[model samples]
Target: MKSALMGSLKFQIPQLNFHKTLKKPRPSFLRGRPRPPLWRAKRLSTEAIQAIQSLKLARSSAPRLEEVFNNKLSRLLKADLLDTLAVLQNQNELDLALKVFEFVRKEGWYKPDILLYHAMIQLMGRNKMVEMAEEFFGKLENEGLKPDTRAFTEMIGAYLQVGIIDKAMETYERMKASGCDPDKLTFRILIRNLEDAGKEELVDCIKKECGKEAGGRFFLKISSAQNGKVAVADLQYHVLKCQKARNFAVSSCEADLISTLLKLQSRRAHASR
Candidate 1:
């Protein structure tokens, strides 16, 4: 009965032109081979494409960077303007990005956005204009905007990248005070910076705060059954070997100093007993 019913129900496949489905329509003006792996490629907004072309022309013909942006570009759709700003950012034309940013800011419908402010701060910081970066951050605060974790992280990185450890630490403390929890990337950035600066004591404290051991272990992984438990000396030796192999700026001397301090404190405790 099942075979009879299956025979009675005949399925017909729809005729689809597979070749047509595989082909993409190309504009008559564009003559080039099709780019493969199209899924990863981003399609630019019309305004962004126009902005790129205008920027190129301005670079060749215009004497000043400001000449590229005119009243017409300023009147673009809000989303398109933002897209153009992002394109300028990717192109590393930060000066042009700032000019466009100012124009956008002055518009009647403009509103504050944290990502925009963050990008502005990062751009200034990258140019070594730390003062302007700080000014932008201050402006964000004046706007009554509560900065998110990325904002705090970017500021910390900006300060650290310029060798301003004090400012970085202050920013970090401020982030914590604001109830924003730092993630592993934040911890690693501060840890690596402090390690390079030879601030081993601070690194130890930070590691402890983040629930990591002195050698940066997330959890105590002991192969107890295989090795019948590893000795403290053996563990220290292995950790030092791993550190040397990794070639991290974290020096062996700092680790040794920490071990020496631990031994001294232990002896002192024994004497007090």
Candidate 2:
């Protein structure tokens, strides 16, 4: 430092002003990192397309599109499709949706999940497909999915809608028989469908199944909707109708005319007397 001061004095020139010269730029800090894409697949699985194609190409007793679901396709199936089927059922597209569902089962990639079964039950009932719904119920049971009140109740309502009271009542019995608690909504729908069909025996059976719980809150709407006609009265009328149906069970009825042998027999009896 002393030598530089001495040299400066010696040099007697102040032209080396490095601080007054140029300056270099500094870099700013960076933040967020990029993320990987979720699903990179471009299209549906080959198995699923084959299944759908097969179903479309099918020739069968049922609609002929059943072959589409010949085998299970885990990658091809989506939860959205199952949910869409549920909505379609409400729109009375049950058979078609069920056709798709059959494919779902046939794909065998996934066991029929609980949600799928429940949706099937709901679809069957909403579309008035009673027997098919019952068949679906049997399938559910066979697959070891426990029936809740909703499952059995939906079946009961469906059977009642089609005037299959015996099946409806049987569904009720089977519900309890299967260890499900019967909810009021089910009974209400049951009573209503039965009453509509005039199936007194079945309605009575439902009431009996309901026992003291017959006076369910749902029944309140049924009563009010009927202008407060009591369920008991309704049930009795249905029973009478069922009996009337039974007394005349023939598909076609023809009364037989009196025979000549009967008249001859009567004449002989009178002469003998």
Candidate 3:
């Protein structure tokens, strides 16, 4: 009986061999999905590589570098890799900068210091890399560095550039929670962004926070929109703003009603739709 069982199993093993050539092409679904390309480990050529190496070395003694080290000079950031990455970014060699950043980040030596993160903020903000810039700012505290006023300002500015109002406000709130005081400039930026976002109510709130005398423009805009109530152009900005605010994945009745009311009141519904 054992010999019969062994013989039966031996016959099955040949057909079950994973290395065997297939008689027909397998269906796509059965073949499993293709893997995503890794952001790290992306190689650069010798010429593009030399361009990065040619960038000026950031001395450990620059003004921005000095300001950060002043906080806790004893705590050097894991030996200067991120520092070099910052210099590449400061020089506006972004493609080379990204390549170096990606490499160092993969090696786990590129921690986010204020200057390093600042360079990224300015670079991405200028280049309109909104999502990536926000991601960099949001991950700050987790990287063991406190974001200073400069970092906060640059981060908030990046969020505003993307017109992500909620994220900008969220970053401001995080700044305050980190025991950093928000100056008048911060409030002014928040108000300006709110106005631009068509959150008239939020703009007014921030205006009151900024002492209200400067809130006249917000009220004027709101009043004009109300007067031209039925014109398609009148509610255009507000309609887009509402579209920006919506969280569309929900199936809740309240979400549906609120969305319907907004559409009904909006003369620019077709545009948003």
Better of 1 and 2 by lDDT: 1
C-alpha TM-scores of all predictions: 0.58, 0.45, 0.40
lDDT of 3 by residue, 1-273 (tens): 999999999898889886777798742210123223222334434433333344323333466333433333223343344444554665556665765565555564445557767767767766668887777776666687778876886778777776777877888777878888655456656766666678988765555444322211211112224565843322222222343323221111121133333433453446567
Between candidates 1 and 3, the TM-score winner: 1
User: Residue 157 lDDT in model 2?
Assistant: 64
Tell me the tens digit of each residue's lDDT in model 2 across 1-273. 999899987675456564475776642111012222212322434554454445345535454442333333233446534543444443445556676677567654558576677668766665577667878888988988887887877777666555677777777877788888776576667766666677778667656555433222221112223566555322111112333222222211111101222333345468679
Per residue, candidate 1 scores C-alpha lDDT tens digits across 1-273 of 998776655332233433345656753111112223221356767766777678666765555445556644765788777777776665557767877888878878888888898878776766667788888889888877888777887787678667798898899899989998776556766777788899888887666555322334223222334467654432332233343322332332232234433443355468679
Q: Model 3: what TM-score?
A: 0.40
Question: For all the candidates, what are their Cα RMSDs to the real structure?
Answer: 17.1, 28.9, 17.2
Best by TM-score: 1
Instruction: Sort the predicted structures by TM-score, highest score first.
Output: 1, 2, 3
Which has the better lDDT: candidate 1, or candidate 3?
A: 1
